[model samples]
Target chain A: MKAKKSGGNSLFSVTAILLILLVWQIVCSAGLVSPYLLPSPVDVVKAFISDLPLLIQNARITLIEAFVGLGLGIVIGFVFAMMMDRFEPLYKAFYPLIVLTQTIPTVAIAPLLVLWFGYEMTPKVLLIILATFFPIAVSMLDGFRSADRDTIRLLESMGASGWQIFRHVKFPGALPQFFASLRISVSYAIVTAVVAEWLGGFGGLGVYMTRVRKSFSFDKMFAVIFLISALSLLLMKLVEVIQKACMPWTKTQ
Target chain B: MADLSIRDVSFSYGETQILKDVSLHLKDQELVSLLGESGGGKTTLFHVIAGVLRPDRGQVLLNGQDITGESGHVSYMLQKDLLLPYRTIIDNVCLPLLLAGMKKKEARAKAAPNFADFGLAGTELQYPHQLSGGMRQRAALLRTYMFSLSREGSPVAALLDEPFSALDTLTRQEMHRWYLGMMEKIRLSTLFITHDIDEAILLSDRICLLTGRPGTISEEIVIERPKSKRDGFAVTEEFLEYKKRILKGLKRT
Candidate 1:
């Protein structure tokens, strides 16, 4: 029964939103709140249509920041894991430092980055990387460490070198976790990018949001809010798709 | 030279001794079993001989050379399949070859012959989770064997620590039968550990009986059936007679 409801509701979910809007318009007409404080859904819709091109342009900047950070974080994480796998002392020394990076909120660190690097893309990108790097590094490190001991023995007995064991047994084992972290980091990257932009950056949706607030454009602000949510949800779904395509075995889970 | 030999091997985990003055001599083309209760030092011995754990005092020789503390002489297979869920079955099977510095395509090609050897011909493209439990075990075995023996430095001995213990009763028996059958084609010295007295009796030409709780080797029994006479019928009177004695010995220990 739950499956049936989910399927049916998914098809008609848009209708539910329309009904809510209709009720919202009725309440506004009934004068329960002032128009300046609470605009009708139609006003928000109008603002959204007019703001479409600029919103897309601003969204592009945020997407770039997020994607670049996520990509760099993934590459760096895998490389760091490999290094750690090779050197135990290095892993022991740096792992706690990596953990420490995550404990310090990116929000608190972003303004410092802005102070150091100014209001260019660097601060936003750095913030996103710091946020995304932790999960990827930790997940991939665990994956590397837990590689099949049996397989490693077999390789060594076969005269396989150390490099060979890692390439064959360890790296292959780490791929699933790598992509899982990638998905997590991608979502985190988006959030960090937005935060970085809000504090000290220009031209992204965050900056546009501050502009909309200053001009007292509440309808436009609502429209911007909707776009941000839509973009985030879409990026998360894209990651899910990539996970399926790259590692189909996880589909069972 | 015999395929493997161990002499006065002793190991401990901090204050607790694991293998107590254990010694064994094995010839090429022989399958030996180590039978004991669960938590006995059978696994500890396997790990010791595989060079995973250093024995406090011992000498291990492979093909007339000292392999004590050697990390790459004998292959080890444990209870868990340890298949890389991210990789396809074919890749898993080719792992040892890959570890030996073979190109990715070449490693997989080398494994093509054995996929059909164990009733796994069509499932190479499938991932570990997609295969049945029995099939995954087979794939894991194939991978272990290929990785250990196919490389330039072939493993002198195969150390199995309850490799089939996790399977259902019927599947475990079937795997045992299959493993025995394969022994005729590619013979190697083997040390198998199992909690089941019947399994040790059936698989090994010699059994090292271990007593748990600060585990120690308490008895060594030689299986006396001629190599030409071994079969899966389970009808051998000697095997049955010894089973009673082994169980009594374990109880006494």
Candidate 2:
């Protein structure tokens, strides 16, 4: 049943993509643009299939970087939210720092990280972490801080200790927001890993693109691009599933 | 008898005084409902009495012992039910017990008996959102009363501030009746704050009427045989007479 459902979904998306391809192919055939700049859908799919194994390999590398960085980013974000909750001065001082970090683009910082850590996984992971941290921190902070004030007051009246209030009220309230942030951050985490890999790397989809470009294999490049998109969609769907699982109350009736 | 007394209590936000030389007392297991309009400082007084806020000047005496600025001695119910939406009803109720260093298993076991008293037995595993307003209020009350600083004993007192304001008229009346029944069954002192004079009279052994933007007790009236009071009978001549007096006191401001 699950496979049937997923196959039906894939068919729907595939149909939608074929329609877009039809439009693109018509536009290109009408000499709207050169083939070099906008490859036809057939050429792209042909390129993609031939280089599937290589694309898959690079994707594995990018996925590792993204997932690892995401784990670190989530941990850091949660701890930062906790610190902000524990002390007012810390919240005031650190909130601005978080915003500052987000403004400094990971693309801008990627090269610097490569220089510092060399052309290793460290730079890619660092870039991904930097890119993904802010949303989770900001969302979780706001969620944790705004946790039903009335509930906290009621808990206080119930003789709840500070830690008890956090454990029972604030922490639970922050989950939905945290999951939302995780969803956003996951995409950013993957894209960041790809971007960092592009700067200079031996492996990852970035490197695969580089190889395809050098050989002028437009089809394989398009295939790699398709795979990357698929990967992102998969990650996003996973996060959505996790979110629903964690917050069972939010499931639609 | 556990009585609470506020002696010459005073408070100010910067130079603007809230309460000045105010005094009120509630005998053991007595319920005193406070009647006032918005910005009347009734809530501030309630906060001070509950030890959530410190009075600029005064002594909050529990059983004639100074507990001013102390914590965890009184239970409070704010305007909303403030149940942790993520937690099961039983977990929310067991919060105070866990805070007071009770083992989770033991605290939960302790809360089991009072679950049915508040008419929240089978719904213990339900999230707060699943329960109706009246049900949530009952669960909140049960949570408050099931845990005390004395390590999971019954609550000493409850401070209810417009706790039924969000409920419909019928539910509000039902909750008021339930509240009275709950208090009598538990024999806990209660300080109820409400802008509705009828509600104040309905739940209180005595009603203290306050006036002023920076409030003060402008009038006080005692309702004898309060435990035997009828619900939805606020339109009775006796109830109407008290409400009229409170309105008059309020108009003087």
Candidate 3:
């Protein structure tokens, strides 16, 4: 019954999106906004088809950076979370600083990263890592903290050591939350990679967007926007699939 | 000597006494229930016995060894199934062995044969979410059994904390029957905690009634029915006699 309700809601969402698209096309065709400023749906579609090869090539660079950054972010998050969880003093001292890191706009750091690492893949990857790791680390820390007290007690009764408690109880308990944060971080990775590339990069979708915008190719710019949306959605879906595959017990629960 | 004994164990959190001079014992292959009201220190006693919490006074003994504040002497199952959602059912069951420094293949091999005994055969590779509530509990019980098995010497005793309270009424009844049957074969010295009087009567060879603000066992009532005659025993005069005595005991608290 609940599943059917959610299914209906999603169908309604799809219709709402299609309706918005139709309204957008109508307004563009009616010349409510200048074609240069807001391309029609048809024009955007045509531009997408024409620029497909270039877009795919540039997107590949951005995607690679995103993946590398995501991997690095996960490792950093896992280690940092473990450290914070293991040491109360570390957690108390660093928790506020960790939250503070998220307050600064990631875009503000892009230029500094570019200056230090140059217009190479390194800066873009680092920017993405900086952008995405916060969610992973915070969520994982929360997960570790929120492990069921009863289960931990169970492990302790079995004569489990501190390390054994973590292996058998804390780590597994934190996984669902870790996967939830992964979905957010995966999407953040792609967006941060693009934002970083825009500040400075040799080749990527963001660099391509800057070039197209300078030439007043709004349709191509819109196409890149749509492609980025698609890519983010795709990455989020991939994470969901992997989470389901790995945590099958979550499905029944 | 009893397989497990708690000699005048008392515990407190700062000023609040959770358990006061609580002494209890379980002989070899015996199953006993600790019956009490909510917040009556049943769990505190479990924690103390499990060595997750050190008592303010007294000792926790396994096979006459004073193991107060030491862990891994007994297996414990919490109220929730507490299955690690990320691992396959078999892997969850094999966790204790893994924690004991057994190799994955060897641990899995040991856990494999008992799936049939636990009535969870063919779910070896399945995730926790794929199983029903009763099945999840079965898997948890299997995990608890494995934790005890991994230890050397006498059969591993189990400490279960209201292991069926989450289940629906019908499922709870069904599990009671299944659990009693399994106990006959496995024969682990067991300490079962429950607020449910019927449940305590149904599963325990003896029910230890815990009462008062800082709880201790007020009375111990033995159930004499053989395993074969336990079915439909709940409606019998003998069952009501025990229930009336227990209710009177609770009133005294």
> Which candidate number has the best DockQ?
3
Q: Cα deviation in Å at residue A131, candidate 3?
A: 1.3
The candidate that wins on lDDT is 3
lDDT of 2 by residue, B154-217 (tens): 3366677888898899998888788778777787778888998778777888888877766777
Q: Which is the better candidate, 1 or 2, if ranked by TM-score?
A: 2
Query: CAPRI band of model 3?
Result: medium
Give the Cα error of residue A152 in candidate 2, in Å. 3.1
In order, candidate lDDTs are 0.80, 0.81, 0.89
Q: State fnat for each of the candidate structures.
A: 0.64, 0.68, 0.86
Tens digits of per-residue lDDT, candidate 1, B1-253, equal: 2388888888888998877778887877788887877667777788778777788998888887888877667766768877777678998787766655678898888789888887799998888888878888888778767755553454467777788888999998888788777766667667887888888887778887778576667788888875546674367677788888898889996
Q: Which portions of model 3 show Cα errors greater than 4 Å?
A: A1-42, A49-52, A250-253, B36-38, B121-134, B165-175, B195-207, B218-253
Against the true two-chain complex, what DockQ does each candidate achieve? 0.46, 0.49, 0.56
Q: What TM-score would chain B of candidate 1 score versus the native chain B?
A: 0.91
Instruction: Report the C-alpha displacement of residue B26, candidate 3, in angstroms.
Output: 2.1
TM-score winner: 2
lDDT of 2 by residue, A173-218 (tens): 8898998889888888888888888889989998878887898876
Name the candidate, 1 or 3, with the larger TM-score value: 1
